[model samples]
Target: MEHEESNRSEFLVFPLSQVRKEGYKVTRKAPPSATDWSRRATRTQRGILDGSLGHYKGKAVPKGGCSAFAAQTLMKGTKPHRIRIEGMSITHDASATPDGIIDTVLSVMRYSTAVKSDSDERVKGVKGKWSSCMRKAGFQYASPQAAANDSRWSKGNVPTRLETSVAVADMQCKKKVRYLDTLVDVQSEYERNAIAEQSATLASLQSDAKVWLSNAKDEVNKQPATKRD
Candidate 1:
């Protein structure tokens, strides 16, 4: 599952703004107004996969050979809605091995441990400014994350009057404090330093990834395309 960008002010504003305009009521089952493509796609894929299973369809799933292949290939027919956000793009390939992607992600995450967001003194300072800004705007949240995670909003089906208000103030405060810009700068600096420190390891990982992708594509090309293709 993709992690919600609760700490970032940019991602939450649009959805919360909609809540403000529409007076959307909060419900236990309601998801956040904003969702990223990865999470959206994952949810779509999971739902479709569940339905595609034979047991779920009140029949034994087709057994053996091409039947199994077709079962696994059910998601190839799904088209998910796309959303554009700053510095983001959506990309997917059914032919790609999940293992290859998982391994590459794990390799990158291993080095990422060197730069924890909360441990950065710069982030802490900007958060302080953001807290003060929110206070001036009539909210008492410690940070954007704190405001987003406030438990009161989740306790009832009715929309809290302050949910939209707090979200608006959160976005405004982030702008006033240049929170995203400063946070990005500090994050980029730490990442660059980490890259410099792990240049050889990262390079090897990238090289391996390229080879894996090339092989995956070749394998896909070897398969016969269906009539739907």
Candidate 2:
């Protein structure tokens, strides 16, 4: 905390009371219990570092053909089948085979742990550089994740001055070391390799899913839409 933060004054002068007032206004306009502004703000800061903020702004959500269509239609309450299980209600076409296929696909997707490990290995050098940069900036963080998850910030309704200073240093160090870009490149390479290795299995799954969806479409077309009071 000895490093002179050039912008520390700016954060200190910002009114926490104003932030609380604005948060109250925002929540009144949003659905009850739907928003957590403090957490959202912190996540946005992380997103900027990871480069996922606004990543899909101009992109269309990829449609999964009949699967996507059936999901969207059912979500809109056009689903004809309704059942209760153990006093809890759920809506899904029990006759559809997509559930089994989805479960199988999810089980196959568990290679994420390996992908993360490989990505960490590729960034070891860059991470060391980032640590050195933070040290020079007067922060003692071992990693960006450590700085972002500092326990001190959890006590405040909004980010404190020290947290803001650390976050700025974290981003600056990441930029200096090109940490995020290199991490992304490493992760994408491993992911591509994983997909290539699983190509045959994935292809078989896709083909089976298409056949099931086609049958589901015929069944859906024959059923009358459910009426609600």
Highest lDDT among the candidates is held by which one? 1
Task: List candidate 2 stretches off by more than 4 Å.
Answer: 1-120, 225-229
Q: List the global CA lDDT of all models.
A: 0.55, 0.53
Off-target runs (Cα >4 Å) in candidate 1 are: 1-16, 22-115, 156-158, 221-229
* Model 2 CA lDDT for position 229: 100
lDDT of 1 by residue, 1-229 (tens): 1122333333233334445643223222355666575555564344444435344345443333233344234323333222221223222244333354445444454346334655688889988999999888878987766786788666666566677677667666776777777767776787667667656545654664565566557668888987873
**89-128 per-residue lDDT for model 2 (tens digits):** 3333533335644564444443553346445766777778
Ten contiguous residues minimizing lDDT sum, candidate 2: 5-14
